[model samples]
Target: MSKLTIKTLAKELGLSIATVSKALKDSHEISTETKKKVLAMAEQLNYVPNPYASSLRKQKSKTIAVILPEVADNFFSLAINGIQAVAVQKNYHVLIYLSHESFEIEKAVVNHCYSGRVDGVLISISSETTNAEHIQKLQSENIPVVFFDREFESLEAPKVITNDYESGYLSAKLLLEKGCKHPVFLSTSLSLSICSKRAAGFAAALSDTGLQTNNYQYVVDCTGTQEMIFDQVKDLLQKHKEIDGIVASVERLAMQIYMVSLSGHINIPKDLKVVAFSTLETAPILNPSLTTITQPAFEIGKSAAEVLFTMIEKKKHSIMADTTVILPSTLIERDSTAV
Candidate 1:
């Protein structure tokens, strides 16, 4: 009924406790033959070392923490897969945390990394995250961090991002050519760096084509559940008959627009055209097919882990990685934008 301990191993192997301890640590003071014999006997006795004790001795947790806004989205889900793959290769365990798009939750998650329970971190900021102080505080403690997909402004760290602004402009141009006169933007946070850049590019594209913001008539600000977004879409169409096209910043809201159009008897392409920024695999299979700006979610995640590992192993100094790297988004044209 007693648990395994170093003293027990020392007794079973007929060695002093200090020798057993040094052998387990593979210290230079312990002979290789002694280490092999001690380790073999310890394994036979079902010995399991205390992780906290090991961490304290080695100054390494052999673990990485991954924090994201939400894992419910397909993009984030795939990103996690990539992170796990790299963690497996490096023999590092991962602890995942979700912020659910709340800035307060993001602040708390970053603060926890100060405990040194994890050796490094990878984060994707929440929608409401606008400040960089929380992330900077972690870096100050020498905890290496890499940002994937989303990030905070003014943070001096390695980042992985997609070309949001160009993608947004391209999507808007596609909608414009599809004969949409009044296209409105639907977004979660126009303040978030990614969302704001995309919106600005979308606006620029509209202006270049001679259509002003007021010409769009209305931009329906949708929030909460899928059902709630659908209702908001319905209300927008009712109140603003001139809204004939859409630029959805998120895929979930874009799907809701399709649902609302079906229930309200509005025809896709004929009455309304849509373009969305999404990493959905089902884009080509939607009712009339769907057009989307797809980001390289998995690639970004893989690159982030690769970069973080370089920093973790290069202990004397952190990585002097290029501050920001932007991967281009691909716009897939489909029936959703047809006229």
Candidate 2:
């Protein structure tokens, strides 16, 4: 049998091609009864509307891009699931890109995405990204961009993020309450805004206890492979035997701390109290368990997707400007931070 088309439906229903087309699109010019008739006939004939043709006519790809630093992170994995849920409901496709923590790679990806490929973009920038020119260029081209999780604060764009600063304060407060006098703030990158905010909060909490700036340790610029991080953690622990508390800004660092402590025969919460911003499913099941400041990653993803779709469908790119949605992070107390 020949493929079904709009004309075929129009002919069978004794309607004009324009009328049938308008009816199929639920155009306001078409009466309700005519729309019902067109829908019924299309359903009866098993006619599927050609999305490509519709896209061409509407000047839309019906797609959105999700750019992330890494997908292996449990937080991002959950966020992707939430993004997919909304994308499927809106009949939109998602194109995922990873920057792998490289700023140059992230800029290149954004440049490539500006080629009218996707209707809108959602991004969680790389750790090394400090410049916002690439993202600003996309917004200037009328492509809506929403930031989630790791974001650039200087950019005048919509952002969905967890309360990193508050969570950091809470994590540090928990450790201090547990009798940790010398807590070290561990982070992979100092350039990341999220890391900075968390470190600030941790520092503020430590300051509340009348600790001097030098006494409240902030160990930024930690990166590289697992072995490198392990070695770094070992050296740091060995050098600062009095560093009774550790606040890891990232989950992998927390794992590294756990591994180093075990190898060194250091007891968790006894010798060193550890807390981290983590979304690991094994957090509760880890050796002695891990205390975590967990972000609402799924909700952040869903909200960012929703905002992007609204901009795409509404044709209003400026809707995302200066908009910020902050979600709360929960501190899950586990055996790792027990007194």
Candidate 3:
């Protein structure tokens, strides 16, 4: 079969080439009825417009990039689905980049995007990201960026985030109410905004309970491989018999804690009550049923995509520095934190 193009459709429909082109581009200059007719004929003729030609005429790549720390977890996976839903509706392609929680990789991807490979970017920054220079450079190149899930608070860009501070405070408050005196918050990073904010919220809760700054130990920072984190948790449990509660900043840490507790023969709830910020589908089916501060992963992703598209429409940095969307998270009680 011959390669079906716009010229063939125009010839067969008895419409001018200009008219067919405008209709295909959805230009308002063409009437709606004309557009419908042209589109129907093009479909019947199996005419496929050259994407490269279309993009060249519009000066747009018609593609967006999604930068993620990792997609192995449930939260990011759900978030991707939400982003794709919006991208499909807008007839845009999505390019995915995984930074693997490394700042260097994230920076490299940002630098690549600066070449105008994508029209816009949606990012969940890596835990090790401190310098915003790489991302700022993308803005300098006229590419719009919106952050979701993880973000740099200092960056003056739109962000879609969960209520981490409130969720952390409430998780700690619940543990205290359940008769836990020495609850510890666990984190994989010392610099990540989400982890630090959650820790601050936990500390704030303790202060509200008349605990002095030095009266109670609150945060325990752990990093490296899963075995290393597991070892750190074990050592912590070994050193502090009074540690009766745990607030994991993320879900993987919560799982590590559960494993450490089980191996060491420590009873959950009765010994160490636990809660975590998680989007795990298995939270309700864990051996003891894990308690969680569940974030709206899907909503966060969807909101970020919508904001990025809005910026894409402006074709420049139209995002207000103060523009932020904070979705609330829910603390679901389970056997892990049963009183």
lDDT value, candidate 2, whole model: 0.89
Off by over 4 Å in 1: 26-33, 217-220, 316-322
Query: Which stretches of model 2 miss by more than 4 angstroms?
Result: 1-56
Better of 1 and 3 by lDDT: 3
Q: How far is candidate 2 from the true structure (C-alpha RMSD, Å)?
A: 4.0
- Residue 76 lDDT (model 1): 90
Ranked by TM-score, the better of candidates 1 and 2 is: 1
Question: What TM-score does model 2 achieve against the real structure?
Answer: 0.85
lDDT tens per residue, model 1, 95-187: 899999898998998888775689999999888887888888888888898898887666778888899888878988888888888888787
Better of 2 and 3 by TM-score: 3
Residue 273 CA error for candidate 3 (Å)? 0.5
Clashing pairs in 3: none
TM-score for every candidate vs. truth? Answer: 0.93, 0.85, 0.85
> Predicted candidate 1: what Cα RMSD to the true structure?
2.2
Give the candidate number with the greatest TM-score. 1
Error of 1 at 138 (Å): 0.7
